[model samples]
Target chain A: MKKIIAGAAYVVGDAIDTDQIIPAEHLVYSLSDAEERRYYGRYALSGVPQGQQGLPYGDRPFTAPNAFRSEYAIVVGGSNFGCGSSREHAPFALQEAGCAAVVAESYARIFYRNAVDGGFIVPFESIERLLERVRTGDLLEIDTSLGKLSNRTTGEEFLLKPLGDVADILKAGNVFEFARQAGFMPA
Target chain B: MTITEKILARRAGRDRVAPGDNIWVDVDILMTHDVCGPPTIDIFRREFGADAAPWDKEKLVIIPDHYIFTKNHHANRNVELLRAFAAEHDLPYYYDPGTPNYKGVCHMALAEEGFNLPGSLLIGTDSHTCTSGAFGMFSTGVGNTDAALIMGTGKIWLKVPETMRFVFEGSLPPYLMAKDLILQVIGDIGTDGGTYRALEFDGEAVYDLPVHERMTLTNMAIEAGGKNGIIPPDEKTFEYVRERTDRAFEPVYGDPGARCHSVRRYRVEEIEPLVAKPHSPDNRATVSEVAGTRLDRAYVGSCTGGKLEDFVAAANILRGQEVAIDTYIVPATTWIGEQLHSTRVEGDTLYEIFERSGCKLGQASCAACLGGPSDTFGRTHGSEVVISTTNRNFPGRMGSKQASVYLASPYTVAASALSGRITDPREALV
Candidate 1:
């Protein structure tokens, strides 16, 4: 696992569901087809309402207009993030758009499982309302080993909840790799 | 242990298990649909090698339902992917599109096709997979990666969730359906109140409902962030299962002194028709509180509210009445669609009532419920306000993000449709 993940923060409020992460209409493209899968990144965070797009300022799209990749690498959110649909496309879209980690007050179960098991991104729970503290474009650094996050732009740091049971899966990159190490699959 | 714990214990080959214990469970069924099926297939192939076969073919149920009515080439191609994979594997339960064996809206179809058995462990690639727990089983949604793991090994690890039982006392009123009860629970507990927990429905009122109605209560468990929702298996459950499948199974229940996270009791008579206001299923208010709120459209459909009984309830309010605003009726499955032609209200069939009421009828599928390709039937294009019986009212759920949706029971939807506003069901039913 990477010791330090540093990037621009993209922030959103509570109950940011899978629909807003990646709309259902964009779900048709094959995730396995290299060319088609790029569409996921292009539309990542596109379904957020026009007013709630990028947080404090709002109306700031996560991905550049018509671009496949996003400028923001780390996402900060309020409570109950990724709360709807079991669509793995939500996390896949974020990762495809170059997201490295998500720090939120909480997460819906399915979304948390998908992120950790798919090795799409590291999902961390912060002890405080990180979205309120971090701006959409603030520079942030997260250390997975210590569960500490620092907002370099503001020169303040926050503590993240321990990875606990999921740290084993994250350390192995994904469930498939973890299972292999555990002798459930051939290495 | 609660019923959910008991079921998980049996599946894990253990005599007893407690909440928070991580155990490897042998699942009995894994269902997938078009939207997530191709990706799951891709992951399964990539991890297990291109030529590796699933641990068991018959146990995997693939039903292509979502994005079925669209002209979008990509969406259409997904069904083809499922077809080619099913043919290659010679899977028996693949319900091919445009065939006589086609089923619609997988959650309901699972029950119709006999895959939803009592005391079994079912995991699906869709969130609403909790609907199967209505049959007194342990069922929950998992993503493609977890689903692929189950496909390759028929086993997945789980943390046993503590149970929170809701017992509905008294009799259900004529205007208040099971949808109101679930919306009420979600409203009281906030969206994540049930996180990592099992929600079990009990008491006389829940048992009095038809087996199909009980499904509506369990279908939206995910909206509450619940792991699973269940009702202890009763004679009604046994009859529903036996009528559809002869699969011999033992029905399990919680021990008399089982541990629980919480228990809530409600007297059905005190409840009124309810709706989850725009943007979230937990944003709840009584129908009277939001009555007369203008709506551009009214829809009655989806796995949660698009059953034969739901249509009957709607038709009762819509008989001899014309909807003032645009309205749509989508049956959850092909069988339910056929039933709409025979099921009657007064002298009119439910289909006839919808036709005469100026409501646009749609084919049996998950059309517009989750906002498929832009051309999907009844999809909102702009800032239209909609009152719908579908689960989930999140932004862009039915199409345009600007469009707002109020989630309500079919009776309330029908009543509101007749008035061109969010009206209480009692206004028309009484």
Candidate 2:
């Protein structure tokens, strides 16, 4: 686990559900096949509404070509991020798209757990004020050890709650790996 | 502690546990459907070694429900993978497709098979696993990874969640169903209100609801971010459970002074028919507010809305009338389909009533609910607007991303189908 992570932020509004993260139509692909699983990253955030003039990430698919060239390592969201469905593909798709973490005012319970258990991505809860201080493409630095987030572009800092045991799971790169290390399985 | 705490405490071998207390509890049953089963099997084999056997194969139930009926290769592969795994393990509870043991939806099948006993701890890969909570059990949904771990170990680590008690006072109105009550609650609390919390429903209204209808309340608990929605088992519950299985089990209830994080009261008399508008379950409004909203399609099925009671409600409205728009009716399970075909509403069978009304009857499965494949029967394509009895209305949840979905009760959907618009059930019922 990196003590401090710095990356570009991609901002989204409230209630971005799992369906929007990865649509159900794409759920047929088997993860056992690596080639099929990679399709998830290409389809990540493909369900997010496009051609909306005012919304963030509007008129653009999260998987659009060159979208990752901006290096969006963090996703900043409003309340109730990952609000619907229990599809782990939601976080897996985001992680596949090179998103290291998601910072939101709140998260749907299952998504929060999936992100932790699968070690797909780090889910951070912060105040709504952080939404105003951060912008898309802003240089955001997160210190997981200190529970602090700093926007280097704006020089604004926000406090995040400690990750506790979740940090350990993330460090081990998923629940299965952590289970093996913790003597839950034969290593 | 609340009933949820008590059950978890007992399962964890602790006299009592509070909210946020992490403990390992024995799982009585671990369920998986086609969409999630293959990955769970793959992961379990990967981590525990392919040659390693499951902790207890009898406790693991696999039902190939979601995409079994479809002809798509990828969708069919998931079932193949599950069938292969079940054969290798000689699992007793594998519900194979096209077999007499085939059950449709995992959640409904679990209940029909008598797996959801009182005081039990069950986990499934599907979010609606909370549907079993109607049996006075503590059940919730977990991801594939967790299901795999549970399959290998028969134990899961869980943090006990605080409880939210909803007390429904007074007799429920004739037109108001459990769907309305739950939609109203979700609308009031917002989708994330009950995040990581157990929602317990009790009161004269809940007690009066039949076990099947009570399952509807618990089924949508996940819509409000509930870890599980439970109702204390009474005579109705015992009668239902006993008919299915004679297994003696102790029912658990909240303490006389069990502390809840929040207690909310609803006067059933005041609740009218409700609908969760497009894109979000919490985006709710009165059916009257959106009345006369034209629809491209009407769907009546899912774990939340596809039960015997739901079919009866729809049949009551569609008995003599013909549908004005395209409509699809899917039973939650194969047993439910059998019930619809065998039982009569008025002089006509429920199946005949639906077919006579020009509704496309689908076989028992999660058809068009998860947007199935392109060939899925009655799946919404393009930018059509659909009024569905299914649980979710998330973007692209049913099929096309451009399709708009409005979720309501089966009665509301059936009535609306007759007029090709969103109509309040009272308009037809009264």
- Tell me the interface RMSD of every candidate, in Å: 0.7, 1.2
TM per prediction? 0.99, 0.96
Complex DockQ per candidate:
0.90, 0.70
What value of lDDT does candidate 1 attain over all alpha carbons?
0.93
Off by over 4 Å in 1: none
Candidate 2 lDDT by residue in tens digits, B76-173: 88888888888898989999998888989888888888888998899998888999999999999988888888888888888899999999999998
Model 1, docking class: high
Clashes of each: 0, 2
Question: How high is the lDDT of residue B273 in model 1?
Answer: 91
What's the true lDDT of residue A138 in model 2? Answer: 84
Off by over 4 Å in 2: A52-57, A65-71, A180-183
Among these predicted structures, which one has the highest lDDT?
1
Q: What is the lDDT of residue A90 in candidate 1?
A: 92
